[model samples]
Target: MSLVVTTNVAGMNSQRALSIADRQLTTSLERLSSGSRINRAADDASNLAISEGLRAQIGGFRVALRNTQDGISVLQTAEGALTETQGILHRMRDLSVQAANAGSLDDDARGNLQSEIGQLRNELDRIAGTTSFNGRKLLDGGYRTVFHVGADAGHTIAVDLGRGTSAAALGVDGIDVTGPGRYGPGAVTLSTAAAPGTAAVLTIAAAGGSAGFSGGTGGVSAYTDLDGTISVGGRSFDLASVRYDTAADTDGNGTRDAADLLAQLNRAAIVALGLTSPPFSSPTPGTLAFAVAEPLPGHTGTAGAPLSASAADLARSTPTFTAAGGASRALTAIDAAIERISTVRGDLGAVQNRLEHNIAKLGVALDNTAASDSRIRDTDMATEMTAFTRTQILSQAGTAMLAQAHAAPQGVLKLLV
Candidate 1:
């Protein structure tokens, strides 16, 4: 195994050493320059996978934070509009209180007060219609709602006061009584209980209580405890008494009472009962009674105006105010609108808070993931420098030994000479 060249064995050894040194130097140079241990998948596949995953998470976090900011912006805009709307409602309420006092206001004064109410209603409608943030209307009253009074199995009447001035006033027409049985053919049963044979008579004929039927020619002389005159369809009838019989069978079960008949009658009346004026007012400590009146002019204008509205127009006899008398109703509607705004704001606040919390959590998560990625891919400069210096020295030594090893092979040439 010995060679003639004394340094041949050393030459091969030095060459192998040089190759190892060159490889180490190249690796150190790459790490130092690139600041990464995993320059390629072959360098470290596991670390490459982990590093890429961390990068994707960082990108998603940044995008999510941006989205949270956008949501907050929209919520803030809606909140601003709601705050202004609340002020408007408060102003309307104050005006209502001013108008409610009768002692200080004459008919003219009350009429003027109603004019102001009309203006306020217009303004509220304008605000509701126009107030929008980012092209979305928040105070427009369609958001959250509650139904009362007129509820049925299939259809329910939801009073939407937010339809601006259209819903401002509701008019109940006078009962157009053409003849008997305007609603339908049969013994019209008015009862105090839910019985079919309830012996309740029409005490006060509502002017617009029935459709296609004429008001019956009867007066307080027909009944008792009624002392008011009501007009319907151009006809007037005096009020009579309201009697609740326990034997009235409104349910058709042979037994009738005040509660059942009243329910049935009111339910039936609600659907088609007419009066160009307000329906019969329930007398104190008495049951429900229909106001009877003879036929008159086909139309007497709007129905039972609210007491506040009627009171406003007493002096004129035919009080006509351009502004409608649905301010109370409007107040209710505006309140509902405000509640809707608040509900949306509350939801937005919750979302914003959650986003903030998520952002904080994401920050922590990003930090941990970055740390893990760094451990796998980041260069250790000190370690790299140490290896680099060692490799440099070994390469230099190998070159010197190569020269000496070549001289030994030259000695073989000398021997041949």
Candidate 2:
């Protein structure tokens, strides 16, 4: 089996040694240049898969972090608007207090005070309409915008800072684009219809609540499921249910009657005005139906249509001022608006806090992802360099021995000679 002339073991050993050396050198070059052992999929399929996943997560976390910062900016802007709005409310409250000192004032004095109060209200509306950040209105309506973190995997949060949709429009919806100087009273007045008894439906679209004419045994109870309080005049209405448009027959009939509707409103106003004590008395069984009195023949023409007051105005006109006697029914509307602002602010605060927590958690996630990717693909330069040096020396020694193997055939040629 030992054929010295034909068979060459040194050549075979040399070739095998050279192949091993070339493999070591290629790995060293890869580690040094690319800084990764897993440049190709065949290197380590499982580890490559894991590293890619971690890298993707790291990229996503970076975007999420930026989004968190954006959320913070939005919150700060909203907070600023709320602070200003709070100041405006305080001023309005003080004016309402001053207006209530009827003993020290005549009709003219009270009217002048009302004009100033009206002006303050108008100013608030102006501020609310104009204040904005990043092209987004912060105080006016349509500020309750929803933010989605991602598709199904992420959560949805609100970014807009206006009072809830309900209070902003006073149960109205959608954006108010007219921008200041348009809103006359806090309440949108429905002008007299073109024709009488033509059925002109004036609607106040209830937002974030269920308010309807409940003709059932239960009297009228307009509910707000969201967490907050709304004061209409001096009466504080608490919303505990999220449902809106629940019918609590304000008209008193098993069926709805528009005239009775106003009467019910007047009653509620009286309660809000603090004319009636809390836990309002239930309507007597089979009570007289609501009747609309005839309009006054003529008023001593005043600038604001001051007509002769009537018996109905007597109950409804009672001041429902707060314990400090600073609150009024007119002021109650402002209080409702203020409460809504605070509730929205609270909601924004909650979202900001949650996002901040998420930002911290995402930071940790990004760090861990980077570490995992490094472990999977990064090479130890010192270890690779040492192996490369050993391979270089072995390859050179094998090349010299291969030359000696080539000369082994020459010995057989000399014997034959």
Which is the leading candidate under lDDT?
Answer: 2
The CA lDDT at 26 in model 1 is 90
The digit string of per-residue lDDT tens for model 1 on 1-417 reads 545754478789878888888888898899999999889898889879989987776666566555555555555665565566556556655655565454575667656755665665566566656765467564565433322111123221122223221113111011111122122211122223223332223332223342111122332111123333333223344333233222144566533333443444444333332322334333322233233232112223233211111211211132111112233333444456456545655765665576566567657766786788788889989988898899899889988887887776775676677
Question: For candidate 2, lDDT tens digit of each residue in 1-417?
Answer: 454866688788887888888787887888878888788998899988888877877777788788777877888777776777667666766666666665676667666656665565565666767777789777766677665442135556666554423223632111111222111122111122225333222122223232322222244333223232333332354323223344345545654432343344445534533433222211222111111122222312222221222222222332222222333444666667677777877977888898888788878887887888887889878877888788888888878888887787787777778
Q: What's each prediction's clash count?
A: 54, 22
Give the Cα RMSD of candidate 2. Answer: 11.6
TM-score of each: 0.55, 0.60
- Candidate 1: misplaced stretches above 4 Å? 1-9, 105-294, 297-336, 413-417
**Please, what is the whole-model Cα lDDT of each candidate in the order they appear?**
0.47, 0.53
